[model samples]
Every structure is written in C-alpha cells, then in structure tokens.
Target: MWLKRFGGGCSREKLRSILETPDGELIIVGGKSHGNNQYKCTFEFYDDAWILKVDADNGAKIWEKTYGGRNYEHFEDIVKNPNGGYYAIGTACNKKNPPWGGDYCAKNKSALWMKFDDSGNSLGKKHFTNGPNQTGFSITNTSSGGTAWVGESKKLVGSKWQYKAIFYKLTGTKVNYSKVVDLGGWNATSIELTKDGGFIIAAGKNVFKTDSDMKIPALEK
Candidate 1:
C-alpha cells in the first residue's frame, strides 16, 4: 500500500469520508481535533465534522465547512447531487439542559444530516433519534428528488440496549418526513438505491432487500 501525504500543516483529529466535486476539486469530509487533552482544561476534546475543498491542481485549501457545536460530531459519508449540491451525514449529542419532548436523547446522542450547495451554503438538515439515542452513518441522493439516510437506532428496551437498523427518506422542504422504516434487528452499515427502484442495504447479520415501496427485510441471517 502506498500512502500519499499532503504537505501542509495538518490538524490532528478523527478523519472520516472524502468526496470529489464536479469542478475537479477534492472535498474532504471529516472531524476536528479529538482525543485527550490537558491544560486545554477539563473534558475530552470534542470533534466536529468539516468539509475542506482542495484545489486538485495545486493541492491547496479552497474552502472549508465545520458543522457542529462544542460537543462531539463526525461525518461518515458525503454524496454529490445532480444539481451541483452536496450532502453530509453524521451524528451529534443533545446538550440541552432541558430537552424537548422529555426524550432521553435530551441527555443522550442523536443523528445528524445536512445538505449544502457547491459554494458551501447550507440548504437544510435532517435529524433522527428515538428520544434517547440514535445515529446515522451513510447517505445517498435519490432519483425521486429526495435523499436517504441509513444508520442504527439505539433504544432502551427494558434495561438493555436494542440495536435496530433505520432508514429515513426526506420528501419535502417544509419539514415533511418520511416514515421511519425499521429493519427489525441488526445494525445497518450502509445503504444504496438501485436504478430499478429498489434498495440494497448491508447490515451486521446480512444483506437486506427493500422494494420501491421501501419495505425492507433481511435476506439472510
């Protein structure tokens, strides 16, 4: 394996996904400074997801977008849309001293999804959580003018953590949401829609199948 290094003063932290822009620019999607730090004072250093556009010709920074609060955040994947826009996916924590809906996630973690134009202006966002804890890792643009996000949902089933695969489809601009399709058990690692209007999803136990109606079932154990 060959490792090509970018000769620059690089910031250290947890790095995630990367995408290529239509104008031949390199878009790097990852997190900011992470790990243990002292003198910086008191708690674990939180990392936020960032988008850095590098000029392919000179390997120089063109622009960057950091998405997060003082808490932890990270982007798992990014997709370029047909309309010269981009989508970024990740997870975040709820820092509210008093959260809405009296949900457990008010004290736990939640998923985050964001979309932006080529110029780095945010278009909108989609967040998913079952009140207490949830997270999304993969995202894809749909042919039907929307997008899909895949991830795992963690909920307190009695006293144990129940892991379930989740898929959310975004439909409108006025805050309309798609039905949260539950894939029963197992963790969904990634999801991709096919040209035939079906979906292929890889989870921990097996590869599942979802029809155009978005009803998915595990094909194997």
Candidate 2:
C-alpha cells in the first residue's frame, strides 16, 4: 500500500472529505494552516479551505488550491457536479465582512459553497447566513442536476435560542432554503440522498427520512 502527504510543513491540516472524479482522479477537500505558526485560543483560527487533486492510481499530487479570507475557512464535504465540475461546502469566518456581502460579523461564520471546474479552477462561490454559527457538513448531487446540503445553525425562537438543522438546494449559486427542522438542541451531522429522491438526515442519536421537499416523513432511532 502507498500513502501520500499533503499540505506538508503546516502546523495543522485536516482532511474532511474525498471525492472521485469521472476521469479516475481523486479530489481531497479540507483545511490547512499557512504562514505564521502562531495559534489562537478562540474558535476562529488561521486556516484556509484547501482542495487537492491527485492521481488516483499512483497517489501523486496533480494540483492544489486554497481559498479563504484573512480569517478561517473550512471545507466539510464535496461532490462532483453533473457538468463535470465539483462543489465544496463548508464554513468561513471572514473578518471584514461575509464573503457574499453582509453587515454583521456574527454572520461571518456562515455556510460557504464553492464551485470548481474539472481542472481545479474556481468558478464561483456563495455564502448563506440565517443566524450565527452556521456550518455545512454534507453535500450531494441532486437528481435534478442541482445540489443539496445539510448543516446546523443557531436561531432565536421567541426569547430563547435553539439550534436547528438547515437544508438548502442550489442551482448555480441560487440557494433555495429547503427546510429548517428544529433539532431540539441536537446537531445535524450528515445527509444522504435516497433512491426515491428524498433525503435521510443523521441528527444526534436519530436518523430520519425526509421527502423530496425536505419534509419529515419518518424517523428511526
């Protein structure tokens, strides 16, 4: 067996997800630290979202790219688009403003989506912020030639705050907020597309199925 090292010489680097291209190439998405090695005690760190393409057979690096602002950026999941490209979803903490343009810094830690061509060239990006602390955890290619993502975010309900599972459908940067299911303070970790074009969400100790519209249909403990 052969092993490969990426983002070498960095104080910290993490591989979050991997996807295989139609041409037998492997795409790795994660976060990597660069420049100063100084660490911080806060949640936001000095990191960037990193995408690496490698030869699947020989495990040799073909190309690598990084995207971020002055603060932190992370990629949690990736999927190949139907148009011979790739989409990566994650969270970003831009210091000045949100990448997609917003006035609040608390919304800086918003859901991020990036599109890249087959050659590892970036196409565009989109950011979503409903409330603070939104993070995209999983993404999948939808049957309608679009994409779907699932994450968790904090939202204010009446006088209290709660965490909710958020889902989104995207078509070329246009995001349709699918559903915001109240998680009762639990966290939504991942999502999968079912054969019937529905979705199965894994939240805390429960796994539930939702219809195509992201409406809860059933639950499994």
The local distance difference test score of each candidate is 0.66, 0.77
lDDT of 1: 0.66
TM-score of 2: 0.83
Cα error, residue 221 of model 2, in Å, equals 21
TM-score, every prediction: 0.76, 0.83
Candidate 2, 48-118: lDDT as tens digits: 88999999998899999999865678899998887788999998874554432233244447888999999
Instruction: Please give the range of 10 consecutive residues that has the lowest summed lDDT in model 2.
Output: 35-44
Candidate 1 lDDT tens digits, 1-221 = 23334312235554567777898888877666432233222122255667778887777778877776655666777888777788888787755442322342333777778888897777887666755666777877766766777787777778777777776766533223333335566767787888977677787767766775556543222
- Which portions of model 2 miss their true places by more than 4 Å? 36-44, 94-107, 155-162, 217-221
